[model samples]
Target chain A: MKHTHAEENYLKAIYMLSEKQESLVSTTAMADFLHTSAASITDMIQKLHNKGLVIYRKYQGVTLTDRGKESAIKILRKYLLWEVFLVDKLKFGWSEIHEIAEQLEHIDCDTLIDRLDHFLGNPYCSPHGIVIPNADGKIIDKPRWLLTDLSEGASGIVSAIKDDSVAFLQYLGKRNIYLGAKITVIEKIQFDGSTDITIDNQYKINISRKITDNILITL
Target chain B: MKHTHAEENYLKAIYMLSEKQESLVSTTAMADFLHTSAASITDMIQKLHNKGLVIYRKYQGVTLTDRGKESAIKILRKYLLWEVFLVDKLKFGWSEIHEIAEQLEHIDCDTLIDRLDHFLGNPYCSPHGIVIPNADGKIIDKPRWLLTDLSEGASGIVSAIKDDSVAFLQYLGKRNIYLGAKITVIEKIQFDGSTDITIDNQYKINISRKITDNILITL
Candidate 1:
């Protein structure tokens, strides 16, 4: 089925909001996430609902139908696979790939995606440490924890990035922090939530609260 | 300045039609090339002209402005690099990469395209034998000849495929013909344009005029 780029983006937003638990997502929440107006979100949601992609209820929210979920996963699968290709194959830094992958996700060729999936050796997860759902949208059930949750002296491998922004990723890259980089927290400042950590037992770096909150880790 | 995908397509069409001799392209010819109406072509050509991408005259057709030509080359460069990645890295047949590349060309990132070019070892020609313009929109000049032009017992390497259709490419692939493959014409059937040829010093195949006209060779 063909969809306008806007419609597809809405489906992806609703899917992500409801990923952890299949719940109805408020239009207001989606509006905030997309940085669009609530009225526009409501309008788009109703359009998606009419297309059998979502179930929208007045004063309630919206939930993806089975068809909608499949579409979202397909879009996400392409995005994640491209991220892997950009980072692993093209040698693009993890932070630099998200925007590029965002553009690549809409290429609309199942054969190309399948070929890339095979070429990448069928990875179980995206470079960001997030689950990359299979053809059936089934994924491994490992939950990721934010780096901000760690206490002083806590150590773990960087599992994923909560903020995949080029600026943030570039900063992390400059500090030698990336997926699978081992880190031990030296201190966590309560005043502003800033974090002082030793990365790979080598460089000691202090990051702002915004940065710490965005780096996910697995203990 | 961002142009819609439609506008970009018009620029590419104008550039391609003008490729051989930098001549003005007629609206009827462009309409024929794009499978659109003359009226629609005039409308788009006007829009592109207003945007400074091309210069159009009433009864005459259009010519790409410097800006328009640059944009077209950029799009073409992305498309060609992806063809290389698909054929060389992902092992897709040369015939299958064009459609996928058509979608990939609009990715809107110079860095991504440049990185891909570097990753693909900076090739000068696409899998189909067209030049891949550099970031600066520069390409080496190499005139290509048609396979149909080859006489009996004449030989050269397969340099490009004029027919980018998957069916034609798949046919060529099945016959073990590809870019850089050596070929010698056994005979050219005069009644029909079909040619019998030996490929790569091994495989012998008889290809219809439809296929031969579309395949290019360089001696």
Candidate 2:
């Protein structure tokens, strides 16, 4: 089904909110996330509901229909592919690519995007470690847990990052922490939730609770 | 001044028409070029005039103001850069890239496009041989004339392509003619306007006037 860019954005926002919250998304919450008013969100939600893209209840909030989920996933696939292109090929910093990819994502040429996917070597994740949906919209999501959740001496490879702010990624860069880096928590300071860790089993570093919470990994 | 995508398309159509005809762009001419009605052409022309983007007269037709030409060129610059990316990196055939690029040209990020230009090695021409404009809207346009216009024994390098239809580009590809290939007209059969040519002063080939007229070259 053809959707205006605005409609697609709203659907994508709802899909993301539902996934993150694991529940129906309220119009007020969507308005805050998208920086619009509750009135505008309600109006667009009604339009999407009429189009069968959403299941909305008067007081219970809304969730995506199957078709709506598919559409949002497609947009996400395009967005992630474009982000990869910007960072991997175009040499853009990981911290500076989202807004540019937002515009490129709306271009909606399946052949162009698929060809771009092949061109970029069909990566499984974006630079941010967010999983990229494949051609069939399947994402083989690996189980990941926060760094702080691991017991002392437990080791895992950094498989994903949950924060997007530039400062956080740059701090990780400075500390030599990134996706695929093998890490072991040497000791845990439970008083403030900081941990001493060895990366690649080569160098030991210490990070605070904020960093541990944002870094996710797989055993 | 910000122009809508529709307005940019109209200005670009006018700029192209005036360049091709070397005269004012009539409302009828614009309507035909844009696949719209003359009434709709006049409506847009009025809006453009109010914004000082175009000089439109009731019966004398319309022409782009300097501002309008600049706007059109910016769109063209983005359009052609995307064409280069598709062919150079994505392995898309020149014949298959124009429509996809038409959608990408509307992505308005100057820094992104400039970085792309640098990333692509700052190409001088698109796959079709159209010059790419620089940051300040400067284009170092080479003087080019039709292949037919050159006399026998004249040598020139193919600098530009005059037609964008898929069939035409594919035909050129099949014959091994491309931007930067050098050729010399060895003989001209003026009766049918067919010519015998040697490409790169090597492989001899014969082409009709139709092909010669569409291949622009510089001595």
Candidate 3:
């Protein structure tokens, strides 16, 4: 079924929130994410339910139907693809591409997005390190090991990170451990879960447990 | 001053048309370009005149002011840059990016476009070979020579082409002489205004003088 940009956004939000929480997406949460009133969310949800895009029940929240999920995934693919183009090709900062991608995700052309995917050389991940799903919603597999999972003396290349927060990315920038950096685990602190790693035969840096958990490495 | 997407489009159309034809842009021409009614065009043009974005005189057509022209140029830059991203990074066909870029040009955010400019490495021309004006309206200098200006046996690269018609672009595609392809002039037949050119040392093709004139070359 044809959907408006506003409807697609609502569906995508519900799909994302549901995935994170593993439960039905609440109207309140949808309203919060969309910056609209709960009543508005309820109205929109009802419309989506009528269209069979969602399975909705009052006070029980909502979960998208297969068609709705497919639509949401398609939007996500376009969004992440555009994000990769913005960062990898255009050199846009990761923090900046989100809002623009938000606006771009609503562009309703499949061929354009497909061609864009080719233009970007079919990037596996966006600038913020999020995996971009393919046209059929198949996720690209990349070699990734968690920083905290590495034992002392284990070595690998930094492939990508999971967290996309601006502050965390900036901290990574300061540490000089960007994507494609080679590093070895020097030590692992038992108490706080921090790790000491050497980068490029030069600087030895201590990474907090929280930060280490977010970093991904190629085995 | 802020302008709506509709207003910006009108200004851009007027600016582009004025560059080729008379300074006065007619309602019928604008209506044809925008696919809107002549009455709607009249209403919007008057509104733009009131906002001082255009100079409008009854029965004399419309002309954009300097401010309007600047805004129009900015929109053009965004549109064309997005086209580059769509084609170069996303792998979209030249014909496909135009409609998507049309939608993208309406996204109102300077930070987004500026960052996008940086992300796309400040491209001077789009995939369809249109020059993208810089932030300050400075056109990027490229080594361009018209196909009509080439002497017999002169060698050059295809930098851009003037025409965007689907048939012409398709013809170029069929001949494998897209932007950035190297070409060497083989022979020029003055009688018929036709020229034979060698492409990438593989094939020599004969092209009419009209086609040659429309194609731009880089020395």
Candidate 2 residue-wise lDDT, A1-219, digit = tens:
778999889988997898889878998899998999999999889889999999998778999999999999999999999998986677677777989998888886778889988987776678787888998888888777899899998999786677877777778878988656789999999888889999999989999999999888876
Best model number under DockQ: 1
**Which is the leading candidate under TM-score?**
3
- Please report, as a residue range, the 10-residue window in candidate 1 chain B with the lowest summed lDDT: B88-97
lDDT of 1: 0.82
* Candidate 2 local lDDT, B1-219, one digit each (tens): 676779878977887788788778899998998899999999999999999999988989998888988998888888888988887677677677877888888887768999988887776778787788887888888787899998999999877777877788778877888666889999999789999999988889999999999998886
Question: Which candidate has the top score in lDDT?
Answer: 2
Model 2 residue B115 lDDT?
Answer: 91
Q: Evaluate every candidate with DockQ and list the scores.
A: 0.57, 0.53, 0.46
Over 4 Å off in model 2, which ranges? A143-219, B143-219
Give fnat for candidate 1.
0.74
Model 2 TM-score, 2 decimals? 0.73
How high is the TM-score of chain A in model 1?
0.65
- The parts of candidate 3 lying over 4 Å away from their true place are A58-60, A119-121, A127-129, A139-144, A151-159, A162-214, B57-60, B115-124, B127-129, B139-144, B147-158, B162-215
